[model samples]
Target chain A: MFWQQLVNGLTLGSTYSLVALGYTLIMGVLNIINMAHGEVFMFGAFVGLFLVNYLKVNIFVAMAGAMAASALLGILLEMLALRPLRRRAVSDLAPLISTIGVSIFLENLALKIFGPQSQAFPAGALSGVQLQLGPIRITLVQIVILGISFGLMFVLRFWLSKTRVGKAIRTTAESIETANLLGINTNKIILLTVALASALGGIAGVLVGLSINAVEPTMGLSMGLKGLAVLILGGMGNITGAMLGGLILGIAEVFTVAYGASSYRDAVAFGIIILILFIRPQGLFGKRQGGRF
Target chain B: MDIILNQYYLQIVIFVLVNAILGVSIYMTLSTGQLSLGNAGFMSIGAYTCAILTVKAGFPVYLAIPIGGAAASFISLIIGYPALRLTGIYLAIATLGFGEVVRVIILNLKITNGALGISGIPTLGTKISKMLSSFGLSRFGGLTAQQTSNLLVLVVLIFILAFLVFFCTRLNRSRVGRAFASIKADESAAEAMGINTTYYKLLAFALGAFIAGMAGGLSAHLTFFIGPKDFAYHRTVEILSFAVLGGSDLIIGPIVGALLLTMLPELLRSASEYRLMIYGALMVIMMAFRPQGLISKETVRFWKRKLGRRINQ
Candidate 1:
């Protein structure tokens, strides 16, 4: 039972980590929380659904298309909305409010375009396969999700550590002004980072949609909140921190629900965040920076 | 025309007034460099307190409203002390958690009546006897029930509006207000200058909560109903939207925002199902175009200068 719950927790955590990675990347680069990220994830799932149901594409191809489309959309959003604001000397609140606005706008737009009803992706044999390893019974889709998520994380780790652009990104994350002085194209790096993050969000959305077999407009708000909590838990602006945070949250939630009441799941998650804030405000893996009011 | 000015319209107008009160309360904290996402929770405390006291304990309605408001203010003070120590996004998150916790507790508590919600308390319209008597009218004398209710609502709204205008003027000019402005500008600098950041932060939060609680009491009285749904996260978001869209710096901004946004769904009734979506989209566009807000006085001055240049050309 413990193992089953642990596997379940891991699968859930993997998806959360994917979403948190997106948040961490953007925050690391721009120092802005893109509230519309969850909406991007939701849109990705809708795109995946459309491809599978209407175009009869394979699941892998559909997910890939969704990720690509979401990335393009992220770039468009940056160009049309975020870029112009950055050009002007605006306060940090401006971007926060603007992103929130974008979040609302996209959610509403999605509702208008897709209608309010929850939609399911086209069903397949992937839904039927459940593997029993001793006392632990797990879905094939859960295993697949875990495997794909790890694969993506590995690729991302390699990309961040090994590439020139990756080093630039790291430098930008460290300090934007300093990175600019070092001859890095900070703007281009920010755009690239946002695109990459959005793609990850999209992939997570598709996986979550497939796992749950339902998609809706308001899913973004809850998912975004959870991803943010994970980001804080692991360590803000740290990819590895986000991963660890996600796993901790997932496992904590699973165990809490299993032992306690299901109603307390959300409360438990929030309680953990509050406790973390009180005990270690910098988060588990986040480096301590200069404190300000 | 008479029907148009009757009970339903009176109800909606009262609702608008209540929302306006809540909006103003939110504006107070926001202007002072703090964001408490727990406005709805404070409102709920006021609503529930008033309802429970008036109905169960049989307290006079006259007494209940102030007591309710005070209770909410005290609660805010407690939460604000520890929570406001954090700044910016952390404070927002902490308050958000606080709001959710309040909601959860209310949902699970036996006194709250849980999901079924407390119902069939004494109607709020009955409590306006003193005001009516002062105007040479007894309770239900020389007026229909609808007329009496409308008068009660109108009187309460006028009273609130007067209070808000007075409060705004005082806050915008006072030393404390200047301190708030300084905190908003730069907290460290404010501290360096010998401002008690902790005291002022708590003051802002408590004051906001008191106003919100009063609004909640008025809302419960006007509607003759109070439910958990009335003070949900969506309502908190809606209040934030009002403050954001209108311009947080000015006192009247929330009032304008609440009036416009509250009536917006009714105007767009044709697109009823997509109303929330449209509202969201409108907010995004507004943020994208005018992050400073719709009625930012600075932006207005800038625009005026540009227009003057065009005229000179």
Candidate 2:
């Protein structure tokens, strides 16, 4: 039972890791939380859903479509909500509120388009094959989900380490002023980072939609909060911490449902976040003690 | 008088007043530069306490309301001490988590009826009627029962507003307010100057909670129902918009914001379906053009200088 639950937790956690990766990346580069990232994720899921349901496209093609659409959305969000505020040199909280406005607009727009109801993906999209390893049972879709998520994480890691843009992102994250001194276009880097992070969020949304078999406008609300919790738990701006935090949160929630009252399952992520805030405000893997949030 | 006293209009006015109070509640904490998203949770605490006292405990509405505010204020102190350690978005996320925890707990507790919520709350209108009759002023000024109830609520709102105005003016000039402003301007500077940042932050947080709690108590009686969904993250965002869109710099900013934003939906009833969308667009536009909000110190000062000179002439 424990092993089966662990498998389920990993599947759930992988999606969380994807979302948190987006959060960590944005926080690292911009020092601001993109409140609309969750909406971007939701939009991605709807894009993938539209392709799969209406066009009967393969899952891989739908994911690519979703990623491209969401990347576009990220750029639009920057132009409409963030860039203006940054140019104006508004208060620190201005961008946060602006992103919130974008989130609200996108959410309500989706509600209008999607009719305020959960859209279910037609079944049998993935091959129905269960693999039994000793006492545990795993579905073929679960294996595919895990593979795709881990594969994406590795790709992200490699790109960040090897690519020129990746080094630029890391340098910008360290100090924007210094990066500018080095002649890197900080503005372009910020834009690119936002798009990349938003792409990850979008793909995660599609994966989650597939696993859950339903997608809705309101799906972003809970997922957004949980992603934030995972980001904090893993240490803000720590890529590896976000991944670990996601898995831990996923497992903890699964255990709560399996052994404890199922109703408190939602509380697990939030409860852990509060406890961590009290004991270790810097988070578990945070290197700096009191750096910029 | 008839138009002003109309039940529909009066109800709207009452809401505007209550939301104004909520706006001030958040403004209290914002002044200290702490971005708390837990005001809605504090409001729930106040609403539930007042509702239960009236429904199950049979306490008077007058007595239960203050107690509710007190209850929320007390809880704020407990959380503020530790949570204030984080800054910026981290503080925001922590408060957001705290709110969710409060909501989840309420959803599971039996006393909260597990999402069924508390109903059958006595309306403020009936209480006013009872009080007027006992004083043999039931027909005082020949007012109707509905008008009397609304008048009572308005009186409460007026008193609260008056207190806020006086309190804000005094705070702006007082030592504590300077401490708050200093902390907001630069915490390290304030600490270096021997100002107790923690103590003042806690005070602002607690005061904010109390006001929000009081607003919640009034709302519970007005609506005659209290539900977990009423105090969710959506509400937090709405209250936040009230302050941000209005202008947090002045005491009147949030009140003006509440008045206009509350009346906006009514004015644009034709676009009711698109109300939130419009609101969202407005927020983005406002942030882009005038991030200081609809009202700010400079605007107020500009008007004051113009009007003051005219009045003197």
Candidate with top lDDT is 2
**TM-score for chain A of every candidate model?**
0.95, 0.96
Best by TM-score: 2
Candidate 2, chain A: TM-score against the reference? 0.96
In the range B181-267, model 2's lDDT, one tens digit per residue, is 999889999999999999999999999999999899989999989999999987888888887789888778878888888889988
Q: Where does candidate 1 chain B have its weakest 10-residue lDDT segment?
A: B138-147
Please give fnat for model 2.
0.74
Alpha carbon lDDT at A259, candidate 1: 89
Judged by lDDT against the true structure, how good is candidate 1? 0.80
- Model 1 has a DockQ score of 0.42
Q: lDDT for every model?
A: 0.80, 0.87
Per residue, candidate 1 scores C-alpha lDDT tens digits across B7-102 of: 766766776777788889998898777877889989999988988888789998778888889999999987787777777777776676667677
Clashes of each: 1, 0
Query: CAPRI verdict on model 2?
Result: medium
Candidate 2: regions farther than 4 A off: A289-293
Each model's interface RMSD (Å)?
2.2, 1.3
